[model samples]
Target: MAGSADTLFMPITNGEIPLGEGQWLYLGARAIDGGFPDELRAALVCEQSMRGAYLDLQMRGMNVSPRVDNTDRFSGALILIGKHRGENETMIARASNMVSAGAPILIAGDKTSGVAPLRKRIAAFAEIDGSLAKYHATVFWLRNSVDFASHFSSAKTSPQGYQTSAGMFSAEKIDKGSALLAEHLDENIRGDIADFGAGWGYLSAELLNRFSPRTVHLYEAHCASLEAAKENLSDYDKGQISYYWHDLTREAVGKKFDWIIMNPPFHEGRKTEPQLGVQFIEVAARSLKPKGGLLMVANVTLPYEKTLQQNFSKVNQLARRDGFKLLKAQL
Candidate 1:
């Protein structure tokens, strides 16, 4: 259990903890360092702040919550938890389940990714309020009942038609990059293909229709994204597609691919972390078979060219317009 003096929870892979005793509790999304305000350290310095927990649902890879040997129990108290699942649509589903089972909820995350609407959606089950901070806001709720699964089950966004949880990025409509990628995909991008950072199967759907690949692998780190991605791709014919709710960076060892497509996330929440893009390129190069190709789309400002050049011997500019660049590299 986290005390008021402790800023963040240690770490855990994918797991749960029994509730503990306290007046005010804080529950964070997966891991400790990745989600929290700079003020978080200060926020945990109060007596009430001693009551906190972390819900780490990331399937695998880089964002995997740190594993703690023992989990402290929450003995039924007012607990606040944060929610930031990197474009995953099932966060609300997880939160709702908690709130319904008698846990007070506190949500926090970036506004650009629909945190406000998630607060409203989660409010359907509890008393919710929000507060603004530097990069994101913290929303809290204390309620009697909540329907965790239903709040997320009814809504669907087409680009791939996955049921969306409120906080997932670009949930309102088709993601701009996905739309652009779908528009430009060629009929020849066949064979076993992979979507690195594949969120909700948007681009995968387009590839399935355009190339009819023998197998389409959708890899996402966050469990919510993995869930939504699976839900979206489930509509397609079985056996032709497979989904892995694991970190693409640490996906099953020795897994090889023929083609990889991605619009890798450059930012982790509000921070401009270009390392994510570079990491994706590195992973793509390692995952591809010899002569296999990797296609990527990113904002022109991002320095992906150097990363691609370092990873692949043949890197070419496929398209460059509208502040976005499409690059292709082959091993």
Candidate 2:
């Protein structure tokens, strides 16, 4: 189960702990409203695309960095543990390594998110000073200590030699939908190509290995996925590939592509939001040259046909199997 933003911020709302002054790093903070304190120098670290929600915060004059990572090394960190065990462990371990030896770290999550077990795991590196239980959530604090770098070693590699990290989409194996999309990809596909929501470079790797496009641009929102993609695609000609940690909903590549391929995500966290996929279609339409084409795969239930027909001069269903449908659209 996923924890709500309210549950994650309950400790702060109840005045159990304060968002003190000085540099503060916030991990997995996807939502921020009046509940957040205004006094601290805050940096919001999130891998997902938050362009729409972040712009709202900016308009409200909230001073927070939209992106931050372990490299930022803030004086303190406010972490909201996620549902993925490996991701939670990695965040805590990295944050422990980044902060000063005696700096504070606060973690919060709901019971369903496994905060209790996470508290125990964190005890290996730091001492839990205090904890609060309210609103079906638990929040705890600790002082950073011990170098936990070893806990997060190199990303796991699959038998196929793809480097994948925990918590990324289809980390354990190549996604069936992506594999289906790959099977239908034409070997003659040439020219500059873009892969939206490219997870760990699976489709991009296939494109490079098969079509050998002149240049392939990969856009991914997740930092870890982007890192894995870099390692997995290292053998390809460096100049022929480009990677971007981008949010497609609110930003554009500023350059058009000859062909674009994607297995666009239809969900934001656990909720099914087909509009996110629609936005991707719209972005692909705008990013494609007048004669460019797009090849995309999505779940069968998603209402993307209307959006595709609206954006493309022609929409063709290429393949459908195992609850996924592949589409080919042209401008």
lDDT of 2 by residue, 92-158 (tens): 7767766777777888887778889878876765678888776677888877766656644435546
lDDT of each: 0.57, 0.77
- Deviating ranges (above 4 Å) for candidate 1: 1-162, 250-253
Poorest 10 consecutive residues of model 1 by lDDT? 45-54
lDDT of 2 at 122: 64
Candidate 2 lowest-lDDT run of ten: 40-49
* Candidate no. 1 TM-score: 0.64
For model 1, residues 248-278, the per-residue Cα lDDT tens digits are 5444525788899999987754678888899
RMSD to the true structure for each prediction, in A, is: 8.8, 4.1
Runs in model 2 deviating more than 4 A are 1-15, 18-22, 42-75, 100-103, 110-112, 116-129, 133-137, 143-159
Give per-residue lDDT, candidate 2, residue 102: 77
Candidate with best TM-score: 2
